[model samples]
Target chain A: MLEVKGLMVFYENALAVNDLSLKVQAGQVVGVIGSNSAGKTTLMNTLSGLILDQRIKELRKGGERITIMGKVIHEGQDISDMPAYERVRLGIVLCRERHPVFPDSTVLENLAIAGHLRSKVEVAQTTELCFDLFPNLTRWRRRKAGFLSGGEQQMLAIGMALVVRPRLLLLDEPLLGLSPAMQEKVVEAIRSVREKTGVTIVIAEQFARPILPMLDFGYVIENGMLTLTGSGRDLMENPEVKSAYFGL
Target chain B: MAAQDTSKQVTRRRERLDRGIKVRSEDIYALNSWREALYLLAPRALPVVALVLLQLLAPEYWQRVLISTTVFALLAISWDLAASSGMVCLGQALFFGVGAYLAGIMNHYLGLPPGLTLPLATLGGGVICTVLLLPVLRLRGIYFAMFTLILPLMIERIIEATKVFGGTEGLSGLTPFSHPLWESFLTMTALWVALFGLRRIMASDYGLVLKGINDNDRAVMSAALNIYRYKAQALFLASATGAFAGAFMTHSYRFVGMPVFALDYSILPIASAAVGGLGTLAGPALGAFILVPLSEMLRGLGGLRIVIYAVLLVVFTVGLPEGVFHYLRRKYTQFERWTEVGK
Candidate 1:
């Protein structure tokens, strides 16, 4: 389970996330849905403690000053000030947007690099699970991740998150730039992930139509403020959600 | 989630904003007020006044030091110009040596005066250097840098082996400036002209194209502009300034030798630019001013001079990576204050 309390992020004078908060229960597929510039990525970065690293770097380079005011509690532990790597050790893994992979490394190597902290047997089991869940990746296990198509890269990114054996996997814009068919395949992969492993997942996406059907609970954020929160079925039927997200 | 408890904890963040004078001076309306007008003129004017005073008042040895400093400053300016156009030139001495040799040849063989030789060498040396480097213009980043780095060394070897233009002995007792004041005046004139002229050019549309090339040559190429031609023009302009420094130094020393192509000429300019700041034309000049004097002051340390000098460079680079000018500029233009947030 994860809880965010009064999470406010500021890049210099610009209010990126303005006093926004949300929570995810264990084994629940939680969706934080927002359009572009809606602070979805900022929220994900804050939750994963990447903003801390960014803040220090910007400070060193005398660039934009980033300020965060919030308490990120993971299973009742205050992880607000935790570093990104330590948060990763705590099983809070974030598959950042844009399908980031080691462009020079093959798919197998990327997965192997991700699971460096795990035992050999555990890595082997997860690698098998990754290949099983995404059969499209099986043939290209030795191919460079850069050469893989965008959809394949997206799947590989998710598989990479899985390789880390994350307790809380945060997917930031997982369906970004993907075709409709690819979206369905990724949505299906998420469903199977939860059904088989029961991993708690938080997906921040702008495309609500494909993702809303899978989320047990969803929060609609606009301009870093939570606009709506309801169950998947409830949100799917809601006229406001339909008009705003589906362009009904 | 309840908001009442969160509202109780109000956090304060430090906010930075430009000073009123800086903002006001950004507009032509600032000309109405003397304070804003003075603010605009001060940073530009102070340097001119300081350099004049330094030349006139400093002791004889320091005055001689000032000439060499000016030479280095001119070279640093040239380096900054080349770097601004996306060319990381590592062989400024190529421009220097070419101009020195050309000026030395004209004065010795053709019976030319300092006046004729300086101008001829400055322009001629630039053309020669540009032609020499033209073949390698297609290379980018470190490739270009590596090519430029080897050129002066290669030329030095060729001249030594071929035994041309007096070879290692070089051309000596060629000419001297009529007066130290005249020499100081001429070098200062060249320095200011190059500094202000390049700054003006960079602020223009042509400079924008050059900067665009630096940012993304592909994007500039897509816009139907010939980036290579623009890069060559920038190279010529940069090399001309470097050549002028070399030509001037030859007459000042009354000698043009293999030492003209030494690594110190190439490396010192870069170090000055790094310490003073890159991109800004004035920053590199300021860097040369600081570094040259600092090197002189550290002369008492004898062998430790280089060690202390290097340590200071590392300290400056690590502690204030933004460079002193940028840091001071920021302090001058902006003010920061802590303000409450989340309420």
Candidate 2:
């Protein structure tokens, strides 16, 4: 449902996402696996059109110049210059890296805030779906999102993104800083999300072991350039992928 | 191959690089060459020389304006210091009022000269201000700002109600500087000294601790440092500069009163700092020099003066948020050119 062609992102002089390209089909679990500083977050930001917002802010403050050169096509329409909010309206929602939730808001309130565009009935239905999908969040519905554990916060973040009822969901390092047990729970939740809602999801992560088996298709990126592309099982067995990501 | 073909298209990006001399002079080797040494000194020395020259050339009325400008400039520097050190102060008047009152009281009651009154009032005012603000030092962000905003108004009310230190009428006919030149000379000296001194302090290790406290006091605390003590020290330094300005102005006008704590004294410095740039001690001072003089020049506008003045400020803040000094500094130190990407 999403196509990135010759995507090049520059933060000042540093080339973040080199002239790289990728595609994600509808209802598919596409994974972009890379180590630290592999431009994973930059790629996610570029796809969601958040980079455009950052570019304007940085320009106004006379900070580092951000140059984006590429086309982001969603369902055959060019969304390269579209702002982040507009992209969201087009049902391209991004759950950004780090468990970023409104610290002061309760879990329910956080979900409600994310579902602002939807009808009250739609929002209520999705909120129930989110709590059901991530059962850990149900107990903390009234508790502040900030007080939630890292794993619980991650669940809340994903659930918050799901509340938007996105056609194409982009998850940036969703399992970051979570324990092995929590990672398994998140991976299970991702599996159930696709099974139930059939949402097209693009997950950018460094932890390949938990996600690789679940991904229908996987792309290995190193230093902002796409290095390998294959089925999840094929990547799991690959020697290079084994050593770099799986730490064999 | 298709990506390679697309990448071949010419795309230019503006590349900024530091000047060769700027890089060279950053090293100790710069001291060996007179050119590099002169390059470093020229920016610093020229301003000092210009201020002196302007004092001699300007008419008496303008000189008086210059003195008041210097006072505002000093207050601006203090504001910048407090802001950079993580204390967003809204009541520069608190410091100014305390110092003015102290100087006025000392001069009027004790029959002290400008020299004795100025130093005593500056230090004493700083101490008093620091003690008063000590309770709210732990309050972060808007809470602290709100407390400071109320302080001067509270003090004004107290003075009015108690009728202490001449109250509404205020203490007047205090000792002025013996010579007009001495007034300008002292103010100019204080301005440069405070500017350079604060800049030097900010560059030191102590300044790093202060800055660290501002950035993340918890992180600084994790490193086993007492953030409160550091904050207190920063508060003392900032208030001292503000108090000095107040003391100087008191002697210059030969009067001190409730008007010392006026919102003009509080706001002018912040506006100057915002226009000039914050963090850089000299930048706020430069801002004051520009803003104060500009305001005086706009006096012809009469009723429309503030309207035009405020509009220009909004324009500067919105159009050039980086402030004049930072922009000028970047331009002076670096050169930019369009360069082809991925060539």
Candidate 3:
């Protein structure tokens, strides 16, 4: 479970996440749906504590100042100031947008690199589970992750996160730049991932049509502020959601 | 209780904003007033005025140091130009040596004066250097850097072995400039011309192509531009400035030797560029002015001179990785103030 309270993020003078807050229950699929520049990535980064790393790096380079003001309570423990790697140890893993993978590394190597903290047996078990969840990846296990198709890379990215055995998996725009068929495949994979492991998943996406039906609860964000929150079925049928997200 | 406590706390962050004059002067129409015009010209004109004043007031020995400082400054500008265009050159000495030799040969063998030899050597040395480096132009990143690093050393060895161009003894007793004032004046003028000229060129459309080549050559190529041709031109332009410095130095010292190809000629420019800032033409030149004089001042420390200099370089690079020029530029153009968060 996660609780974000009055979370505000500023990149210089620009308020990226403006007093936004959300809550996620254990074993639930929560969707933070928003279009581009709606601070989805910023929210995801804040939750995974990756923004702390970015904040320090930007400060060192005299670049854009990143100011985060809020508390990220993970099951009642304040992790707002925690570093990314420490957050990872707390079983919070983030699959960053655009399916970023080591271009030179094979799919197996990429997964192995993500599972460094776990035992060989645990890694091996998760590797098999990932292959089961997304069968498309099993064939490309030996191929370089770079050589894989965008859809395959997306699946591999999720599988790589799974290798870490994350208690909370944050998928940031998994369907970005994927075809309709690929989106369906990724959507199916997410469904099976939750059904099998009952892992609490937080998916931030602009593609509301594919993601909305699967979300246990959904939050609609615009310009860093939450406008609506409801169950999946309720949001799917809502007139405002249909007009804005579904283009009905 | 906890929610009330959190709500009561206030947080502040420093916000940087461009000065109103800077924002106004950015547009052509808004420069209607004399004050705005002066504001724009002051940062540019003040440095030139200061350099002239320093040369006029300094003693004879320091006057000579000023000339050498300009030479290094020219090389730093050239280095920064080449780097901005994606060709990271490690052989500034290659340009310096070739130009020195060309000028020396013109003066010694052909009996030419300093006036004629300087121009000829600069152009000829640039062409020759471009031709020599053309073969390795396609090599990107460290490969190109390694080739550049090896070049001056290779030329040094060849000169030593073949005994061509006076070999180890080097060409001496060359013609000196007409006057120290003329030499210093000419060098300073070239430094300003090259600095401003290169800055103007980089801001132009042609400079955009060169920058595009550096940023993403493939993207530039996709736009139907020949990156190689652009790169060669940028190389020629950069090498010419470096060569001019070398040719002028040859006459300044009244000698040309293997020391022209020394690592100090190559490294000091790079250090100046790094310390001052990269990309900005004036930044590296300013860096040269700061570093060269700093090195001269440190000469009084004897053996510890180099140790202290190296430590300062490390400190500047590590502590202020963005370089001093960028920091100063930001402060001059923008003001920062604390503002309440979530307002």
The candidate that achieves the highest DockQ relative to the unseen native structure? 2
Q: Model 3: clashing residue pairs?
A: none
Which ranking of candidates, highest DockQ first?
Answer: 2, 3, 1
Span of ten consecutive residues with least summed lDDT in model 3 chain B: B1-10
The list of candidate 1 runs beyond 4 A from truth reads A118-128, B1-6
DockQ scores of all models, one per candidate: 0.36, 0.43, 0.40
* Comparison by TM-score, 1 against 3, better one: 3
Off by over 4 Å in 2: B1-7
Interface RMSD of 2: 3.8
Span of ten consecutive residues with least summed lDDT in model 1 chain B: B1-10
C-alpha lDDT of all candidate models, in order:
0.91, 0.91, 0.91
TM-score of the second chain, cand. 3: 0.96
Model 3: per-residue lDDT, tens digit, B205-284?
99999889889999999999988999999999999899999999989888888889999989999999888888888888
Clashing pairs in 2: none
Candidate 1: the clashing residue pairs are none
What is candidate 1's lDDT per residue for A1-248, written digit by digit as tens?
89998888889888889887788999999999899999999999999999999998887666788989879999999999999999999999999999999988999999999999898899889999999899999999999999999999999999999999999999999999999999999999989988888999999999999999999999888898888888888888988889989999
* Candidate 1: Cα lDDT at B51: 86
